[model samples]
Target: MNQYVIRPVRGDEWAKVKELRIVALKDPAASVAFLESVAEAEGRSDAFWQARAEGASHGRAARQFVAEGPGGEWAGSVTVLVEESGTTDIFDQHIERAQGHLVGVFVRPEQRGTGLTEGLFQAALEWCWSLEEPALERVRLFVHGENARAAAFYRRFGFEATGNVVPVPADPSAKELEYAFPRP
Candidate 1:
């Protein structure tokens, strides 16, 4: 693919946002790495997409970035959500301090090896590092244990396994490995 522009997703572009997410959920690797399925995303209403985009576009706790192809199609996307101290139930971990959790990372299969993932991470991390006082101390993500390709890429990006593994909620027999990038 040609060089694409990576930028924050606009609040009003929720329809495109929903479309891209459905496409992402259809990828082969989605079964192992992503939580949602294409059918599920496809069934959501316009209101769902509108709310999601609005939350990420302006919410203080999260941000979403998209990579746009030369012809204006969305090539990829990544979202980061801030998990603050005292939150419970999702991941069931008590936060000792503020941290940014990377999630919803998806890139088109054709765009896999073009350094787009790196650029995506740079954009996500820059946003994480831009947080205000009592600033973020680290960024983390959980990868499926069976996804060796993703795990290796995370390592290449400076994230280290924290020796913490959580069972995937959808598949109890599978485990997700947590990796962290300590803030400098």
Candidate 2:
């Protein structure tokens, strides 16, 4: 069995984070799996990655969970961002409550179905609900309409479709389906 550890990433690990993210963007499923492209991410400055890593480190409102293999390779990663009530989200939608929005989900092809994805999510969700000053009302994620594999995993994990669909800003012809796990 492959051993792995799930934990929060640190500010100095920006290089590895950038490397993994760029690999994710190059994946064949990138168009539907991520909102950003390799060209776009590659164009970003080192300072951007530095801030991204720093902001997503432990104790930050946005946290990135990494699944590290025994060899120190990152098998997968997921990020959860806390959105305060009445604030505008990435899509400019008004958030109705303090909530956790799941994003940047990715796993190495070899790591898929090995429970690494679940481990990454568990860490992210634990951190989300642990917040007290602004208690979270739910955890949510958006899957591309045609991404059945991801949709199935989310459903299996207890997420239910909200019947809410939004146009993918990057591809106006395509849409994204909303899924959520309300605090239980």
> How well does model 1 score by local distance difference test?
0.88
* Candidate 1 C-alpha lDDT tens digits along 63-82: 99998988888889999999
Assess the local accuracy of residue 164 in candidate 2 as a C-alpha lDDT between 0 and 100: 82
Ten-residue stretch with the least lDDT total in model 2: 58-67
Every candidate's CA RMSD: 1.3, 1.0
The residue ranges of model 2 lying beyond 4 angstroms of the native Cα positions read none
Poorest 10 consecutive residues by lDDT, candidate 1? 85-94
Give the residue spans of candidate 1 off by over 4 A.
none
Candidate 2 C-alpha lDDT tens digits along 1-184 = 2499999999999998899999999988889989999999999999999989999996648999999988889988999999999898888899889999999999999889899998988888888888997789999999999999999999999899999899999888899999999886
Alpha carbon deviation, residue 51, candidate 2 (Å) = 0.6
